[model samples]
Target chain A: MTVPSPIELVCPAGSLPALKTAIDHGADCVYLGFKDATNARNFTGLNFDPAQMREGIAYAHARKRKVLLALNTYPQTGNWASWTQAVDRAADFGLDAIILADPGLMAYAAKTHPQLRLHLSVQGSATSYEAINWYHERFGVQRAVLPRVLSMAQVESVIANTPVEIEIFGFGGLCVMVEGRCALSAYATGESPNCNGACSPGKHVRWEDTPRGMETRLNGILIDRFADGERAGYPTLCKGRFEVNDETYYALEEPTSLNTLELLPELARIGIRAIKIEGRQRSPAYVAQVTKVWRAALDKLKAGGAEGFSVLPGWMAELNKVSEGQSHTLGAYYRPWK
Target chain B: MKLALGPLLYYWPHQSVLDFYADMAEAPVDSVYLGETVCSRRHELRLEDWLEVGKVLADAGKEVVMSTQGLIESESDLKVLRRIVRQRAGGDAGFRVEANDMGAVRLLAEAGVKDWVAGPTLNVFNPSTLQLMIDAGATRWAVAPEMAGAALAEVRAALPAPLETEVFAYGRLPLAHSARCFTARHFNLQKDTCEFRCLSIMDGIALRTREGAPFLTLNGVQTQSARVHNLLGDLPAVRGQAEVLRISPQGAHTRQIVELFRATLDGSRSPADALAASREWMVEEPCNGFWHGRAGVEQYVAA
Candidate 1:
């Protein structure tokens, strides 16, 4: 009998409770980060303290679950000490891998603590195989989280060219531009993902009632206006509606999440090492439900029957109920939706 | 420090493009970076026209460099990159190339070219990456717009000697680029089939925040801050840090902007007076926050 290939389910855990919930719910691995600028999700009341991280890693290790530490933000000049310390701490805590993007931090990790495995964060914007290989050859990056800007065909091509394991965004908020490089948030609000670890930061967001309906705004620009009784999506710059000529439309990207539940088999066939679920700020219930659904779908796919392997419609509906905007998109996997 | 005219992000008539450089030949600028760096659909000046203009700039005693498209989305884009590297090989026409993407870096290096400019789009953030590019044959690199002055200082200190540094001293900072065309989409057109609509707005259309505050400018796939970054005052501080100051091409009064930078750099003008004089030449309000390590839109004057 042939052995079934186990698909690694890399789930996000923003807090300790979420980490425990994800591990208990069958996540093969859980990724989390510190509660500061050293990590990308530098939101208030989320992420781990040093004690919490050490305990979280121990708990996951006891359960035979992997823990990946995200130290992904680009370090500010003259202030790389905090990021370097985060890498050192992650190595001390015995993380399964240290996810990093900055070239200096990558070099530091490679030199200071060579034992800790390195995974290139999507924030690195390793779009091409050559770029990925450059990181791998120079810094010994074992795996790379592919940028959301790539297509499935491009992903397959990258996997064929490079020796590193490839992880892709199986589900989450869609970044219209490549991560770490976008300055739209900083240009508007003075805060950016690269510097402040947030985009369209909540402090600058306001929803005002207009004569037409509820108008959603970010840094004082109209992102969307909902009619009476209509739903209002989160006001991000890319998802905002603007008047280009005479008519108003979504100038950048329509509000959507990347849900690739239908393409699991094709992705697996193409030799993808892992699938990443992207909402670390989400609640444990949402994480549990999404993780369980993907786990079931992936297990069924491994059983070799394409029949009866359809993505559960109810699961998708549940995802929409949580935080979907007007709809969900397959993102760059199927087609480029803007 | 010398003056380098950055690629013309705006679309102009064929004659205007020729005329702009013809005027630039007489300007005080030391180098001129020619070609389209925003949208590939802009064909006002193709490879041949750019080369022709490059020859004109070269003959005018300006160091001419050919810049490639910032976003390479298709096989056709790669072909364009290949052609650029081939044309500039072996000191042909005495012109260099500015690689906007890593693919361009590989192609240029493969063509056995020894010297090229690293355009701002490459996102060079650290010393090692900068050194790697330098080793690969980058003689000069325009620091990405968002990198603060403090960061620039660190990279400058770490750079191998003889590598010239340039800063985006004056312009509407080019923030981001993508496959989608915001200018064409403004007219309800698809990217592949959009009519050449970007030509209408010589300076990209201004974008405002929800509170009706001018925030950024949208030019096709490239998003620019609405505030034009005029670092005329910061020139003296960055003078030692950067070898060249890049002045992005705008609609009107570009020659005057170039002259102001040159005069200030040459110590013939005061930074404060030069900054005050720039208000007459800018298309929008001015900002220098990215250089100050603050919000890109916020203007910070050194005390």
Candidate 2:
């Protein structure tokens, strides 16, 4: 019997520099989206243009790294032309695959570009093996990016049942609810993660100085109020603190980064085909460091037991130096924190 | 356009629910979609009781469409879905089913049923997805609540001929659903052992932000906008695209809402008067932003 190589490290890059950095740092694949609502990271100063996407794909492919284009946002009813055009352009760019969430887009892609390898986006929120199998049977989806809401046991169960390749989020900002299904953002800012690729967009975010301390708000809803000397986290909707009964608490999720760096060996043992890093809006240097560390850790795990190699220390330290406030969580991978 | 009383997303008292629909029988709404769309734990109306309500509405000259649960968590949920798709009134044939989740779609499709309503929770954002549902058995589709009117026009343009499009014109917009029930969690109850506490709040309990602004409403596992979406004014603009307009049932003044929408559609009431009339019916503020591709909270006025 022969042991297969460990799961590939699929990373994210919001810009050309980040893509190059990730590719140089041993990323097996890199995923990014266009600079529009067609992709999920429809932020102010992130994502690629047509020329940049073409060049970025070439840059990654030259380094023997696959480039997956994220055409993940659900097409707005009348403006599906832009989404359709995005898919056509992605195929024309010789991209490795297009990660899709919408069933209509999947049907269109399957019909128009039958040869283009399709990976189901996590935004599809396909939790069960039956749902995954539905996409596989219907659209011939090559891989399915498992939503971050699932547990490792669920992942194992899904892997056991589905023939499609499985990709799990390894690091970055964690969503408490299933992706593309959540409307908490829309509840506040009128923009939603499902429709607009952004959750708690920076344009709506504000850090205000109050008599209490520093109050962080998104779309005028105060998420957190920090004391004078206390650290204030980014005002994301899910990470916000709210009063349920009389006690104030984090209603959605605690403000934390999802770091499963220590669970690499365990994940690899479970037949996960790919491990993905979730931040597409991070700096190039941040991408390089995380990718390099994970690459080294994965290589070490392949050699033997992952003894004396814990990504926790380096990952925590490096990420802290970049952006850290109070703590980090393993998200649904470990426990469902209240 | 025909009027569809969307699924009862809230948990009213069993008697109040019975009374509400009984009153709806006299209302101008053409169709009534009964059963639970929020959580299965909400047992104000069981399958038999929903069918019973359907009988009264049917006798009153209203079409009855039994809706399936949106978040099908367990095998019991699947069983409920199966019953909705299979159970027929008076042993004639199954009632028209509205498939909310993909499981419902799969169940109905496998049963060889060819006419169903694709519930808004199906997230049919484009024409291709709409066509897929139509091919699978859907004769009509309720556009996702968050979809803008412009986007809807595009979807309508690409839709296969004869498939009716229903827009969520009124009611508290269902924002999202999860396995974890916020209402149950509010009482510090685990989801599995939830004491059916969701029934206490006739409408969902409103969740306010730290600044004391209305943020959202929690109904079992489903989260909805605190602001009820009133698109009566914009109805004229997109009226051509929609063959049916859905008015979701609220706890209070639901019959009045039905009348207002009906009058507006019938040209008896102007959009401005209907908009003003809506204020008297809603428990919270109204928004029409998602219809304009703006924030869901912004009530955009047509220029």
Question: What lDDT is reached at residue A58 by model 1?
Answer: 86
Q: Alpha-carbon error at A303 in model 1, in Å?
A: 1.8
Task: Give the range of the ten consecutive residues with the poorest summed lDDT in model 2 chain A.
Answer: A319-328
Question: B1-303, model 2: which lDDT tens digit per residue?
Answer: 899899888888889888988899999988889998777677868999998999999999998999988765444666787888887422455579898777677777777788889988777887778888988889988888888788888777765586788888988888877655677667777666777887758778877777677777778778888898998888788688799999988888988888888888889999988998789889898999888877787778868
Candidate 2 Cα misplacement greater than 4 A, ranges: A1-5, A210-212, A217-224, A243-247, A261-270, A300-326, A333-338, B12-16, B40-60, B72-83, B86-92, B193-195
C-alpha lDDT (0 to 100) for residue B108 of candidate 2 = 76
Output the worst ten-in-a-row residue range by lDDT, candidate 1 chain B.
B207-216
The TM-score of predicted model 1 comes to 0.90
Measured on C-alpha atoms, candidate 2 has an lDDT of: 0.81
lDDT of 1 by residue, B1-303 (tens): 788999999888898889889999999999999988877778988888898998888888999988988765445666777888888785655478998876677777767788899888776777766776887789898988888888899977866585798999999988876656677667767665777878847789876644456666788878888899989988777887788899999988999999998888888999999999999999999999888877787789767
- Cα-based lDDT for every prediction: 0.82, 0.81
* Deviation in Å, model 1, residue A314 alpha carbon: 1.7
